[model samples]
Target: MTVTQVALIKMPAGNEYFNLLTKAGIVFDYIALMWLLALTNGVLSPLFPIAYLVVMHATIYWRTKGAILSSISLTAGYSTIFAVQAQFDFNTTFVFILNLVFIWIIGVFGSLIVIRERKHLKQKEIFHELMFTDYLTGLYNHRHFQEQLRIMTRARQNFLLVMGDIDHFKQINDQFGHLIGDEILKNLGGIFRDLAEDYDAQAFRYGGEEFAFLLPSIEETRQISFFDDLYGRLSSEKFSKECLSVTMSFGIASSKSGILPDKLLGYADQLLYSAKANGKNQVKFESRYTYYYSKAKEEIAASKQ
Candidate 1:
């Protein structure tokens, strides 16, 4: 959530809230100076960003967009200053005057920090997004997909888990250049995402040419229809001139039972092998076969036809 949303949630809005926010804001200004007095334990050490208070204050002062809410958070964060201040008598205006002067100096530092923080925040957001995404396909990576599975299972939805493997993917890479193979993977990811995003289903890049789909709100017995629809979709989508319209072998398992994470995945893997063995471009469920290497060999032999 944005800082504004947080502020709105935590404090009442309007002039009354603004007053509390301003009080906190000023305390932030005061604390900045106090910390500089004994430079060691203060923000200047490892967390120099704290010393850059001028950036945050100035941004609020000029932007005025979330000024009130921002101040509320600033105040709440630095309110501990009251306890620290209680330790120092200072007993004079001298401390106050010095504090203001220190703030003025650091405002320059804050200005630099403000520009940099904006860029830093943008970078942080991108880094976090990349963590969820697969490099080969634009779909969510396996780690993120599994996380979603756990969340959905906890929510207790009737869901279909479809595991997909590209037919004869290694041969595609071997016959064509790896670069071309990669483009196919990337293209397929986009195709799957477009297909699933609207259905409240999620598509994921489980690794290499294997993708996963979680179709929520599926009825227990109608799970077969879900795979058939997906199979038809994949069979119909167009590809670039260099690439053929590829078919996927799918293993679909529906669970109202909601198995634990490891077991659920194991079941999906077994079903994936079943589909691969039964013949490429088919879907299966509840298949006990667990051998991937052998199933892959079967797929390779079948692909030559």
Candidate 2:
């Protein structure tokens, strides 16, 4: 019974029908156990209170409806057992009525406590979400980005940090107005949101016309492919005006062992400027150590040949 209760508790909370079926099964088991005890010990078994306690505890997870159902079933079971085994006298009738009342009281109070707890938990979740989420993009905010970056650095996990900027964004705003610029930002945000979901990455709005992505380390070829895909997606977007065309430039820096978050961010920022200087609507990536190591290997191979 303890194992069964634990299993029920571990099950997903979203499946209403499954939870209902499992709760019904537990009630049936309790009823069967009660009947067995009544038949063997003349309906006045000392162990019956323990069974009632189990029923009440289980009803906590089921809420008010479950509590009411358990109370009715247990009361009916006890009354039937007493009718069959004991004579209907004043004392017996009084005890039976008291037991029914006790069961109902336990059910009502247990369910009420659970309801209160669930409401409190929901409120906390909503508060935390608002604290970490960006209002405009619906992505994580800058504060969360800093927190996650620090966590990754502390753990020494290898990753790639990308910094992106919308090309000629100030000019676009001057030409089209801030309202149109806002719509453009929203469109870019939607694209970033979708990409992050598809690639298991984190995207953040690093203030106006700037965004960031934290992606798990992958092969250079795959990283190039990822950049190409993002560029294509941005180029293909259509805004309210047919004449508007949007493009973004991005720079990625690979994490190194024991690298500080600030230095890593600076490196990516430098590369972003490099992309803009060379030409806009492009991506640049840097990994100094990896480049040197590969060069050394090629030199060694040539020397051996």
* Model 2: residues with Cα > 4 Å off, grouped in runs: 1-99, 171-187, 235-245, 287-305
Scanning candidate 1 in windows of ten residues, the lowest lDDT window is 42-51
| CA-only RMSD, every prediction | 13.3, 6.9
- Candidate of highest lDDT: 2
lDDT of 1: 0.64
lDDT for position 111 in model 1: 48
- TM values, all candidates: 0.55, 0.69
Residue pairs whose backbone atoms clash in candidate 1:
none
The 0-to-1 C-alpha lDDT of every candidate, in the order given, reads 0.64, 0.77
Candidate 1 matches the true fold with a TM-score of 0.55
Model 1 alpha-carbon miss at residue 287, Å: 10
For model 2, what is the alpha-carbon lDDT of residue 218?
83
State in Å the error of residue 48, model 1: 33
